[model samples]
Target: MKWTRDSYRWIALAAGFTIILVGYAMRNTFSVFYPVIVSDFGWTRGSTALMYSLTLLVYGLFAPVAGGLADRFQPRYVLAMGGVVVGSGIALCSTPTSVWHFYIIYGIIVAVGTSLIGITPVISVVSHWFGSNRGGLVFGVLGAGFGVSLVTAPMYQWLIATYGWRSAYLMIGLCAIAIIAPVSLLFIRRSPHHIELLRQKDTDTGGSGTTPGLSGRTEEWTVRRAFRTRSFKLFLLIGFCNMGFAQQVTIAHQVYFLQDVGYAPMVAASMFGVFGVAFASGNLSSPLSDRYGRVPFVIAGCLSTAGSVLLLRITPNPDSAIIPLLFAFASGWGLGVVPPACFAAMVDRFHGRNYGSIHGTMILFISLGGAVGPWLGGQLHDISGSYFSVFTLVQAFLIVAAVLIVFATRPASMRITS
Candidate 1:
């Protein structure tokens, strides 16, 4: 069976989008359970936070393995297995009777599921199908899954409210299997080669039958080669620092911080919706890097994220309209630029052959930062009794991230050019 060129593009996009949606939906469902799980289980705040941290740690650690698997085997199979694991884990979560149960199900199983179906594999697939100009746009559009959870989270919350948390987990698990499994089996193909007739049609029409502007040069640096490069080291440092700040200030603490600043629980949750919107908006800006260069967008985003941290620190009240506006702008700007720039740069530097393995390794550092951020935030809040210390620390991290980005852009250093 072969697909037409147009059909191939659409199928690839759909596959990419499906992976994003399922992974993000599973990841964000945790927030809806936070309050309820703590109350019912009598877990300490730190203990509950640890579960999420562990999830991040595992997801990050396993990403490289997942990527390697995708590289070695079929992406569709990897994704299908991921759906099964994640759906089962979430369903099992409905029956947890102890903290370790949450740890094993949510922290370990679901984390493995996420790594398999999440951005690491999706990005690798997308990189195979698109070139420089369209790549950033494609990545941005697909990456919008991270934001999709904003809408899904509330829906999950409503489901939990209507039923019980246990029922909610079961339902979400069912949804994951129903949605992702079929999509993976029916639509996902490893590459354009899967569609022979489509290739002929494209070649007949004078199309290259490959991504436009792609050199088709498969010179890929292995994980060892990538690590030996100065650019890779700098990227790891930048990713660690930037993700640490973003995860701590936005993903982990924003809800609690909003509550501390006098907003109701519902309001705090709504603010996450706004954050999602900002996140999507920021992603939209990535393609612009194709025209203006990745350096400017990367620098601007890092600086803006730093500025947002400062705004939160200095604001008299986070509930104030001005604070939300500033936070949204900064966060959106940062989130959008970092992913596409970082991804494109790596591919450009290393080329496509080893993209999965190299990028997967980089994501491990990003995941490590994400794992530490929330745990550190919870610890700091427990010690200081306020978000001020955490915000200050985030600001410092962002500043360091910005400095690393500048260092990354220097001439005479290895940089990726599409």
Candidate 2:
């Protein structure tokens, strides 16, 4: 009946995963609300999409600070605070008086809040706990928090239909605070080895019988040296291209895209929900990257994403719904593959005391891409009256992303340029 040190990592993983579900569920709900918000406010499509971009921009900007904070302190403190900020923003969004208000409240405040509890902190902490072997699998598991969207996507639509958008936001916000805040404050550990923590149970000796924390890691890339490395730059660019260009457009607009092609609201949402499941499937399978090399999975994901976009472009409407839905799931799966692989790659090469900061810096560039992608997609769609060009651009970026990872995967020990 006595739990091992290793069991603590799984416990933390489960806690972190559940906490993140609130933030991601809120984020995914945005795409579903994209049309409704625009219609309610009479905003142009580009302007509306710009709101989402702004949120990403803000998320990008604050991500490093969150990363630094988590690196310095415990994830519990950062996440608890993030839950508060995110909850407040969501609740305030219920009564946005104008576009500027929405921009400041949801775009800025919510973005910052989510950043506090976002990928950098959550994944970094988990990575520290999990060590190298399970990195791909655990990261994938963390990402499956996004899979909560499968349930949330439909729930949001139903709420919007029955109670209305305002009520939906209010309810979701309150629940986010109620759930995420206490759980984070109560459960998360920065890593297994915060002195006071390890004293209690020595969980840092990781249940796998390996010492957790920064015990075996070497080649501690200072933030400066990390900046100079080819790998870091490549990683940044890959994130920008993959996450910024491809991911933004897909996450922010896919629901609308389906609706544009004549799919109904609930149906579109349900299909989008299917994508969430696909994302989880991909995460579950991400252990492949851990067993294999991160590069192969990264490359495969890029190709799969390109294929998904191509399918979306060609599919004609309500009739081919199942096909697009399948591709959407594949798209989610592909997305699920790359991040953990990329993070694991970073850990292998750059891990040191400052992994969180380095990852945060990379996230800044990625966020920049994410910040602009949705606006660009929306504006392009508005001007050209089609998404063909957007799809083309996505394919190009993803290919480049794949190529970048090829170089970034170079063994960390070989290159030590300061």
Candidate 3:
């Protein structure tokens, strides 16, 4: 039997989504092992965080190169190589005897591995598989994989409990190989056709605003050229501030923060879970931007997230279960909304030919932020003896991110040649 274009697109979409979900699950779940690794190594929180920071830096730096490889070659091969590197690198961490080893192995090696099949490449490839008219919804589904992984704290905790952290590393390593490698080898594909031209949706009636491209010409851009635009620079700033400060600070320290404030580890994970659920909801809802417009949703999300950070700061009891959950819900919703919207906005302007490379370059900036944020947060905690200064920084970053979202609307004059 033969499959219709519509039928197989959905099937491929599901496979791609699952692959993304699993890939991120392996990467994001590392935080659950944070305390254990520190205790085992007798490393300072700052130093331990340094490893994570270094990893993010390496991942960010390599992301664009990976994107270019995917564009130039076949993405499946990249994904396949990523599975081996990720799995093996993670497994090797089980034996590392020093923090420097971790910095080199988990930090550098794992980061490089994760970069290849990461959001930048996957979305770049998947975009080709779907129609531009449905781009918002398709990418939203893809982004949900990363958002939902935020909820996997319990699973990570259980793995650590059932098997020690070393063994847990081995488990995830094996899973990465078994799951990601096979899926990539069997199910993933390169979309051989050109992307359907973007449909400009009218805000008033949720209908197509105009035909594709500028003045009836399909505009394309290069990664280096996109960096010359005002909007792209603003986009870079938002990515940098958000990833470098807000997200890394939260992910690296929030669990420990909850514990410092009298919450148990499980309770801490629960807060992350709440954030994850709200985040996943946001990802799912972002597709509505197809009708509603991407910028408004991103702006709303940035404001909501900023408000949550402030609320967390002011909360009389970080120990109060209900309050943290409420804050998490709001924070998660905001972050979840921003990613898809931001990604779509980039595609709207700088898409075609070098989109993967361009997206990768953006990821590079975001990675720089991720690399710096965790280490900075850790140092601040050591100096101030509280998360006050760290969250203060997070609030400031969110403000910048919010402002950038407003200006990152597609640049009317931006265009480039391959």
Candidate 4:
């Protein structure tokens, strides 16, 4: 069967989804490995988590550069190199005998590799293929890849249990290299124009279909001009508070918290999978925000996520299965809902030639939060001897995030006419 213009968009979307799934899975597998590594090396939780923090830090720092590279060059080549680098990083992780070795391999190397193939660049590519009409749904589905990657948590646990962490890392790394490099090189294109899928000039709508400006005149936005606006600044805070702090803190430490509260390791891993399932559901649901408006979903997602932390704090029950299930689903859905809606909103406003760079910078802020969150969660746990303070801080951040979303999405604030 030959690929047509109509079919190629879906192909590109699938390729993007696969890249995100495999790349993010490599990063997330660290959660499953956390306890095992600690057990093997006798490192303090705070010290052990610092490696994860370093990855986020590096990922955040490099995101804009990755975005800029994707914007200026053939994204396939960039993504293909990312596949090789990330795979090598993961594979090399198996050989680390010391903390510094692991830090260099997983923290800096893997971080840079994944940043190349991550949401910033992938979304930049997809934005060119898709327009505003279906942008919400498209981004939602694309973002779902991240959530679905989490479903592999249980599998990672099994791999570690059966073959050991080293072999598991090696196999996963090999698979990433074999799969992502080929798929990205073959199927992913920088834009629809590369494939000869040309729409009418009026329908071009840039990458994301429509500009947020009511003028209907498409204008290009440089990073500096975008920075001068309040929306971009608000989004930076949103990314930091929501993606960086809340997400990183939760992802890095949720398994440990569950295990600490009397749940077995396997059980905690399973619960992590539950969160992934719910996260995909919430992620996929963001399309509704296109119709109803982005603010509601963003606010609701923030509140729901905040409430889940509160739920876990008040009702710590390892004996009953319900609490874990409820916490996982609620938190996952709430967390999942925010990003696509937020991304869609960003694209609605800022999609242009330089969107990749703008989006990458946003991820950098998120990475900064991510860099701090896991380490902070670990240190807080070490200091308090419980997650009580950590949960409180998460709730506070979520509330602030909710407030930021309202102001960020306000109609009066977004008057960026060309």
Candidate 5:
């Protein structure tokens, strides 16, 4: 065999896409069950929301471990095992008779599974595939999972309505096992090295394929080094501010906010669907960063997100219909560009032997912000009986996040090699 372009790249992309879609579809569907779980278990909204916060915490905490495992072992086994755990956890969640059971199954177990199979593994594999044109298109395709969930959520809702929530869980769990196992076994390769071997006739004829001067250089910073860098510190701050705001609005209160203003349950759910549409569309803008630049799009996305939050705050009831759609578009674009842009910047600044480790550490910080946002939003709502304070706070954070992005862009003397 000879190393060829067509041999394994497309196979890897297809498998990667399937894994992402399934993982996110399961993760996002949790919101659809939030109300039902609360009603059935007679738990307070705050209690139910606390589970989400805990889930995020666990997911974040487990990410680096999962990333390290993927770096050391085959992703196929990790993904297959993750699918089994998540599927079983969700199935158990459906049958739980107590709130603690819900927490154990949904919050801990399912979250662990999600963390293992989610962004870290998928992005790591994709990163190994393309270098120059990697950031925009890869993230854009991965972000499309947000849109896919719009379809999955409603379908799940219908299943719950017709067959009951327990049945819906069982169905989805089976689907997860069916999809993830074969895809991982058939398509996932450890690295470009594996792909190169599959395409080459002889080992001696094949080079490592890494860039020449970039190979075997270990000045690459560890997680500690990344923390010490001015750029990394600024990136962490930006992540905290932006994610704190976005998670609150999008995850914690968007549905309730719509219902309070005037929309019915069905209509409110559809509004989330619209938000998904905007999210998917924004992903399309990510690839453009390769052409223009990362920082510019980050600035644009931040401003757009802030403007949308402002619009949501002031819109009257009659105008609320238009607001959800607008907010979705703004948020979609913002989210679409941010991850890839930020990750690419990190790689550019700190391309070391431990890229997975460093990036995973940063994500853990962002996940902490994610945990705080929703829990805080729910607590404030419980106290104030309105989301007014929460939305205002979100706007403030977005502005601050924009400033952090600008600040993080200052030229740095540090560079990492292989």
Candidate 6:
């Protein structure tokens, strides 16, 4: 198929959406895998959960390096290579005999692979296809991939039940390799500039479809300059507190938490699926942030998410299904809004040729927060004998997140480039 400048952006979007959906699914499956790993090994929740913390830490630390690579090289090669690494690492997981083996294999290897193919690089590539005018909308569409990945929770549970965790992981790894590699290589491009350059050779219109690059109008934002700005610092805080810490606390333990309270494993997984669907719904709604404003949506999302935890805390009957359904939908929708809006707001302020590096650095702080959350939740549970303290902490961080965004998105902060 001949790639027109107009048509190729959609193609890139679709490819990115697919890659993110599959890649994040691999990460999200950890929730379902959490209990099984614990049951099989009889490890303490805190120690067993530490592996996940290590994974987030490694992925966070490596994100800047991945983004730098995406900026300097062809994204196709970078993403395809990441797919291979992710697949290999997950497949190798079937062979680990000790907990430390997981720390090495899943924590370091798979984490690095995920960083390579994760939101940082994918957002960098997609940003090239559309200008900041559509950043929220396009990013919402892309962010939906993360939510949709969660929708596969039931399927993952079925795999674990039917095939056993080891075999299920091997199958998932193979699928990741098969799906991510070709789509990335065949469809992802360096930027619209390459497509426009080809279009210019074919006609005199000079590729009018291409969105203007940020560097043309704004002062170039190097990684160092972005770090110096107050907005960037606030963004880092929002990412760490809300996006990383509160979010990971839920993602890593929601299913297990539900099971501990009363719901059966499969039922808990289904509730997670409901959460995923609602999350996708919120992501689709994020385009409104582009119209109304990013900060309001973020603050609303944070409050809504925190409120959902209260529903979980007050669940009159986990057996009835209504409360879990409400909690899942409300929390998912609320959690979904902040990420695309926050990142879009960042793009509104900081996007440029060096944005990949800047975004990667932002993700690093988020990862650090993420690294703490799961382990902390597990430790809190270990000490308190319930998720009560864990849920309370989530609400506290989310509220703090909402307050921080108010400062992060201030008009004075938005105007600063250095």
TM for every model, in the order presented, reads 0.87, 0.91, 0.90, 0.92, 0.88, 0.93
**Candidate 4, pairs of clashing residues:** 132-208, 132-209
lDDT of 2 by residue, 320-386 (tens): 5777677777788887678777877777777655677888887888889988889998899889977
Q: Please tell me which model should have the higher lDDT, number 1 or number 5.
A: 1
Alpha-carbon shift of residue 167 in model 5 (angstroms): 2.3
Q: Which parts of model 4 have CA positions greater than 4 angstroms off?
A: 193-218, 415-418
**In candidate 5, what are the lDDT values of residues 1-418, reduced to their tens digit?**
5534455665676677788788767766666777677667777667777777777778878988877777656778888788777777777776788877777888899889887777777666666666535667766677666455554666776787889888998889878878887887777775654345333423323676443544475554668877766788888777667754464346556766776677765566667777767666766677777788778877777778777777777654644577777776777667556766766666667654455667677667777877777777777877887777877777777778777877687775243222
Candidate number with greatest TM-score: 6
What overall lDDT goes with each candidate model?
0.73, 0.80, 0.78, 0.87, 0.70, 0.88
CA lDDT of 191 in candidate 3?
A: 58
lDDT of 3 by residue, 1-418 (tens): 6766666677667767777787777667657788778778787788888988898899899999888887766678888888788888888878888889988988988898889778877877777777566667877898788777788887777778788889888888888888888887776775545322222322312646443344465454766678777788888888898755677777778777777778777778878877878888888888888888888887888788889887767644754687788778888888788878777777777777568889898888988998888998878877778888888888888888887777778554353324
Off-target runs (Cα >4 Å) in candidate 1 are 193-219, 314-322, 415-418
Number of the top-ranking candidate, with lDDT as the measure: 6
Looking at model 3, how many pairs of residues clash?
1
In Å, residue 315's CA in model 5 sits off its true spot by 5.6
Error of 1 at 362 (Å): 1.1
lDDT of 1 by residue, 97-176 (tens): 99888999999999999888888877777666665456667767776666655556557657777899999999898789
What candidate 5 gets wrong by more than 4 Å, as runs, is 1-3, 193-219, 315-320, 413-418
Cα RMSD, each candidate: 5.7, 4.7, 6.3, 4.3, 4.5, 4.6
In every candidate, how many clashes are there? Answer: 1, 1, 1, 2, 2, 0
Q: What is the lDDT of residue 33 in candidate 4?
A: 94
Model 3, residue 84: displacement in angstroms? 1.7
Model 6 lDDT tens row, 195-240: 4533443453355643345225445677888777788899999999
lDDT of 1 at 316: 41
